[model samples]
Target: MEYRKKNSITGVLRGATFSGLLLCMAALLAGCSKDPAAGPEGGVVTVSFAAPAIGQETAVQIASAASQAQNGQSPATRAALAENTTVRVVAFTAATGNPVQANYVAEQTYYMSGGKLVPCTVDDNGSFVAVAPDAKMELERGSYDFYAITPALPLGSDKATVSVAHKVDYAASATKGVTVDASKTYTLTQLDRKCVRVTFVIKKSANFTELTALSVTPSGAGLSMPNLPAAQSVKMGADIPAAAGSETLTVPASAFTNTDATTATAATVLLPRSAADILLTCDLTYTTATGSSRQTSFSSTAKNLALEKGKHYTFTLTIYPFDVSFTVKAEFETTISDWTDVPAPAYPYVSEGRYIVSRDALGSSDQPLHPDWTAATMPAHNEVSAYNALSSEFEVAAEDCNSADASGVTPNPGNYQYTWANALPACAAYTQAGTSAGQWRLPTIKELETIYAKKDGLTGVGSFTSYYYWSATELSGASYGAWAVDFAHGNTDGNGKSSHNYVRCVRDI
Candidate 1:
């Protein structure tokens, strides 16, 4: 005889006649078989399972219950459930009708397809079709208990030991006693998923630029739930490693707003329900603008968290910059008021003045001041003295002073006791306003030594090469020589006037 197939088997059973209602009631009432429905020859029982009727209200209750179970507090608002992907069904038979402790009957898994439960089918060639909807299983007629779970269980040993592969698995089960009644179909509902839904919302401070990685691990007791049958306790052995099993989630850029309003959200994690509190430890790694890497960790333990089945918990974490420490060099005051006891005092010489030494050696204007100390051309003794008659405040050419041409290929020397004093005013970088036009000159040996003494304070502000710098002082008896200061060791020595050395112009204001 043909049997009538109905849509939404769960909804139909909810409004069936009193006799049909008894059969429906038998689904959840384990072992209660009063007057079994008679079946055709061979007594074959047909059973079908469907997805739970998860409405917005039911979704909210599930989320609320989950939050209260995993954390001592419940969310102010309810949350929506994620999409259902697959379903699993298991059958058990016992003379006493207690499915939880009865003998294993049969088991099959199905996946969601076109909004229906389809059993996984295998082809003749040994290839398996992973999903097929409305899968029905025929079993020998008897009073048998049935259980159905969602997101189908992973393939493993047997009903006594089943493993869940997903990071977050939503599991629901319904136990019903079915008696074959001329090809009867039973729809399963009110399955309690034995897991908690957890969503993590991570945020970073302004000082942090990129979030390299984030990891969450549940530590301490309560990692496993007692709701599972004792015979199937071995399934808990498949628990994900605490430190490992970090979700491969990408935190979107929009989640990093300055107002701490932006957040990177992780997909829901299906954690096993527990009777005790579970502590979650989270680690964050990030980068900074200065090319520095930093790490921080947070630990939150909900006191007395009795994780109930089918609940949801949300966690919001805000990461701040780590405290950093550094040292700054002290600087000497830049003012100097005395120029007394000097030889060959000139007309524009003032008793009191302020002087500034060039922080960098002359170099090509296109080069960076800090590290690029090499320049194309440098003036020597003869070129500096040739301009002595013109004006003390002469702009010195960038080429070698001893060279006859601007190309610096031909060497030429003038009077042996040459002074860069006349050429120093040309270095506009070191010259100050309201001072004698030619006052900007090469520093004396003593003045160069003073600058060397305060080198530490000028570290970042000035770029000084560890070479010799030209000084205004001439070697007392050496006609062709002048004194130069070694910036490397702060030593003064006499060198040929025509010899090329670095120049750091100085000016008094």
Candidate 2:
């Protein structure tokens, strides 16, 4: 009988001594045993395990999962494990020629020792001994399947024991069996892992300056294997930190393909592959200029995310201001040619609708409006569209100039034609000729002064009475009085709220 060898490079000698031939024949005869529990009839097999290069995507997933598990709570931090972290390897063999139901035969922990994984043995007392690069196992002379796991914490043979918290990477090779032979040494290499890498990228807008903290939580953090029972649900989270004075958070270089100096990213996490959807929630906290703090949250779900054995997924979040308003051309035409030229008018350049105001109001101390106020020079100031005195340009309603009825009659019987309460609603209801309803309000004192200073430019366009026009700004110390602009002399003064005056409305660009 001749001994059969598999996965062995060394060949047997053609001519052997009589005694050696007899010994080989006996070993070959013993290799025919069908019982797996039977003692090895062949020579000892030295099995060495080597990890293939986990592609960038897989590496990122591992890092991301680990980061989330370790830092998912308050005061989050990065994971303790790194690229070179020690990983425990375990080997399993089929109990009855079926890889799905396997039995653990050997275990060894390895670390990246000088760029390669060096195996270590755990004694009965749990103490570890630095061993040779390979793990030796003795088995009966027969074919056997091998299943292995890395980062191998003690996850008994059950799938329920495997968790994202443990960060286990799985690999199995059943197509090629290790045939034990008494006369040869067999080696097993290339145990590739089945896992997914996840990365999170956070971006903030310039207007969101007060953002203080950010955190990400992931749902359904568990492993899904083909032969094992489905895994239970798990949640993991991580805190993401932003760079100083920047609109980005700091992420590891391994997480992104383009690592330019200007880009910031969050740490990558690794997770076991799953057939179910993975959901993530992001929470952000910010403070206002008044020292008030608030928190906002956003959610993103990867529907039916079937993470393959070796792939990467990235999630991104962008935080912006709650209120976003931009200047849009009013519905009505604003061309100067549309206005009817009148003789001996109170002001000039009045159109049928609203006027095209410069960004900076005339006589505005912030910046002077040039005679040639083009769009470039007179940029729109929508930020201060409300009542800020520092804003330069604004549109004024031509209603008051059209007629006395459009001037807004007094809502109260007192001397004041319009109180603050009365003025606000009147502006809301006021409409100009050939224009739709708009979000109009009483002009600020600065806006009134601008219209008055530019009165010479509008001398022939529209009619204006030399009287004080009410402004939205109230006297800082006097609750009973509000500021007013006297168009007659382009001067501003505080007047009693009870005192009646002309009313003109203004709206943002």
Best candidate, lDDT? 2
Q: Summing lDDT over every window of 10 consecutive residues in candidate 2, give the lowest-scoring window.
A: 325-334
Candidate 2 residue-wise lDDT at 289: 61
Kindly list the per-residue Cα lDDT of model 2 for residues 1-509, writing each as its tens digit. 13346322234344346578889889888776544334455444455444433222233334566666787743222122233434554444534533332355555565445545566654332234556545544454556554433444344454213333212333322223566455343344334434434445554545456554433323211222222223322211111111112111223233333232212345333444334444444444445566676665554333344444333444444454532111111111111112111122222223333453432111112122222222223322222332233232345666452224334534545333565556655665566655444456666566676667666555434556687778767777777888787777767888888776777776554
Off by over 4 Å in 1: 1-42, 54-84, 94-97, 100-102, 121-129, 132-136, 154-161, 164-166, 204-262, 268-308, 320-509
Output the lDDT of residue 203, model 2. 49
The CA lDDT at 198 in model 2 is 43
| lDDT of predicted model 1 | 0.43
**What's every prediction's RMSD, in angstroms?**
27.2, 20.5
Clash count in backbone of candidate 2: 35
C-alpha lDDT of residue 297 in model 2? 56
Model 1 Cα lDDT, one tens digit per residue, 81-137: 233355567777734533333377787766555655567754322123565555567
Using alpha carbons, what is the TM-score of model 1?
Answer: 0.36
lDDT of 2: 0.44
